[model samples]
Target: MTTATPHHLPGTDLALEQLPKVSLHDHLDGGLRPATIVELAADAGVELPTTDADELGAWFAEKSNSGSLVEYLKTFDITTAVMQTREGLERVAREFVEDLAADGVIWGEIRWAPEQHLARGLSLDETVEAVQEGLEQGVDAARNAGHRIRVGQLVSAMRHADRGLEIAELALRHRDAGVVGFDIAGAEAGFPPSRMRDAFELLAANFFPATIHAGEADGLDSIRGALTDGRALRLGHGVRLAEDIEVSTEGDGQVARLGRLAEWVKDRGIALETSPSSNLQTGAIAQWGTTLADHPLDLLYQLGFRVTVNTDNRLMSGTTLSRELALVADEFAYDLDDLLVFQLNAAEAAFLPVEDREALADAIIEGFEKAR
Candidate 1:
């Protein structure tokens, strides 16, 4: 969609973007086009750091790459600012889907906190409807363009805020519409999933799915709370769950000793929505190492964990789903087969009906075979 073409796997003619993929942890507020931001900001009278689209895009990348949590978070403030009105939300959501389709995403779960988009006086219900409209429009547009894609909203509640129960109910209310699940996002350190236990309990009672943001800005204890208290079906950026793993060298080779928490996650087949670039920018993988090569994703995958690659924040991280996969493949020497595993992992972990997930799995297999 942007100027950049789909990246090909090194040493192969296969274009990574041509493969079917599923995105579980992508944020709606984090994937806006820089040009859209400028136009939206201009209409809303919101001043930006720069008016040039290229410069604005670079600005987002610069702040997100600064390694300061505060600076990284400020980028969202700019994005959410432009998405307050119904029209803005709808347009952004529509473009989000088009971009995902262009990146060869067959299925995507877009997560964003509705509470952050209420500045224009839209009620929670209205906000959800507005986004759903945009998503549907995007789907139709993508289909017309010969790109078959499906998307569902993962209605997110800000963890630092006290609206978890309200957001969870909204998600359930719209379950038949466009929302697929509920999630609690935003700051992950001090605010544990336990803070939203009541909301999670409500979702559990209603048989609604949820994926809690855990172990990204926090540690294993937070992840434990996500499972025990939040009852998350999948973990958003659970990259830090690797903290429970202890790797050591022996006479013949190396071995990874999994702690109780890590073992539980691995044995349970809980999907880890890992975004390589975002994890590095947010220091989620700092405890493991400094670069993508040092990321614990490879370790988790080798240990038989359900590790699905993602682009947590496309605009902020300056990446697409394809780019994310390509980056990981380069870092870990992953071939087409390894890449297929990641897509299949995501397909199985998608919060969809059992039949739908199976169909998605079949599609992935077919697409990968064709790409090969």
Candidate 2:
């Protein structure tokens, strides 16, 4: 069903939620509805810091803003705790799609580690099927409500854990069902993509696409590992790729010189999923500055990098994709065309087949044209 489109660009009547968008880096666990978490926790008998939906939401925001990765990750413990059983996974996945549809997302890739959901004794394959079932239900519901939406699962392997190869195979096994791609997430600093070379190698051999979490909590070296070892087609929250570029002030202008690594990424048109609010929360953009305006998204976009806006964690960051877009637009002084470009970038970077990607791009253009 359509949710209220409350967010709009400054000094304009354009509602950001009315624009068709594509979400690539959104975490399934990170986007759970606060009320859903409350009910699920009760059924699962999990202890939460707060049972109130509003209070729980605020708690997530507070924990995520603690400026420590450990603290930020601790928030997931609560969300994942209730997602152990088939019912929990199904409900969460279904609601995730409905929320995306409400936010005007015509296409979305919901990424989560199935490994974490096995605490209740469900097989890895079972978890994926449960989520896929929910996703289909949500899509049907959205269509019945006159909102067209499509969603795909990106099965993620936890980096700190040693189940990369198994998770990668699981993704491949379900590719024909609903899985679109594979990913490695959790604890980015110490556990590089090289640690899971076998898994990446398997995916690459199978001609599967992967998007690794790099250039977020880590730096250029981690990004290198994601590209070389993980063979990632996309970089999740690759905000720190900006670090490899040297910007200098020239006569009334600025010039950015790309390093070898940055040149490789740019030349390849590898998509950078830049989530503005979450970047500030996790200190991903700490070196640049402590505010949204200081984020390198504008610089990367202006320099022709395939940069896409995302709400890394809607609940934790207290944002929607629409709200994130409005915030960046306000900070970067972007107009309607600029906003549409970001959506188009995400559509192109989607892990769909070439024909599907082109169709999504065409739909985005038509929607934006109508809005204009």
Candidate 3:
């Protein structure tokens, strides 16, 4: 699944796709290849907007750019519909890892809601097992292909659903097997992380880590809830956290003031999994501006906030981690050093143990140095 050519920093030969990267937030159902979807749709008896793979990919991109999270999410119904069976899940999950390897991801956490795939008679546990089986196969395939790619499942509970605690327990059950963490996704405006207080409490009691979706479709309050209620170790698209930072011009340069909430996130080093393209498509960065130059990723990075680049939905956004970094780099005029910092930030924010996180960071540095 590797691309014929790698994505590079604009006006530079530095191959962004060849650099080791750590993806902290990526959705499984949202990353399917369009051709695979057309094939699976027939087997799963699902209808599609088009049987043509190229057109199907274009349809997803257009639907996702609606500037509304709810509207953008409608595209997932088609992807999730085709992923109901064991074979469908396995193929999607396997291709997911291979795609990450193709984009030079050293490690990634693929998040998906298991409850969404149960319409075809698959139980919660059964869905997790099926995906994990596929992940193992994907990892093995990547290794055989000479890509040092590793991945873990961050089982997500749909925020609009009432099965948070149930899904949390499911993640814990597979903690040692293949699952690495827990997440709550889907609609974000009304359903704050506080709605899943019991699930967070359960995870906290067992000392398991969580990364909650916040500051994307919602605002400061949602980010607050993610920290206080969800006990999130990382934030899924916490771009709107920038709303709390006030920048004012001083004698010469501008000085930024961080509100209490912003300070806590920065001081504690809670990672913001900011996906530039997806942020724009979801209107997550609308308050700032309509283009990449307006993205708070650069602001967050300059302010020393622990920010990690991601492709929230590869197929929907028509991107890879490499393309994300390259796009942002082009907008912000970032250099290789800046790129390495993002990768190191993500490695530290990964759900792996402290020692393993250190090892991952080392690998990223080693890879970047070689590429240089």
How high is the lDDT of residue 267 in model 2? 94
TM-score of every model versus the real structure:
0.99, 0.98, 0.99
Task: Order the numbered candidates by lDDT, best leading.
Answer: 3, 2, 1
lDDT of 3 by residue, 31-142 (tens): 9999999999998788998999999999999999999999999999999999998989999999999999988998999999999999989999999999999988999999
Q: By how many angstroms RMSD does model 1 differ from the true structure?
A: 0.9
Which candidate model has the greater lDDT, 1 or 2?
A: 2
Q: How many backbone clashes does candidate 2 have?
A: 0
Task: Write down the worst ten-residue block by lDDT for model 1.
Answer: 66-75
Per-residue lDDT of 1-372 in model 2, one digit per residue for the tens? 436558998788988888899999999999898989999999999999988999988989988997666679889998999999999999999988898988899999999999999899999999999999999999998888778899999999999998999999999999999999999999899999998999999999999999999999999999999999999999999999999999999999988999999999999999999999999999999898999988999989999999999998898998899999999988889988999899999999999999999999999999999998
lDDT at position 88, candidate 1: 98
Question: What is residue 367's positional error in candidate 2, in angstroms?
Answer: 0.2
Q: Give the runs in model 3 whose Cα sits over 4 Å from its true position.
A: 2-4
Candidates in order have lDDT scores of 0.92, 0.92, 0.94
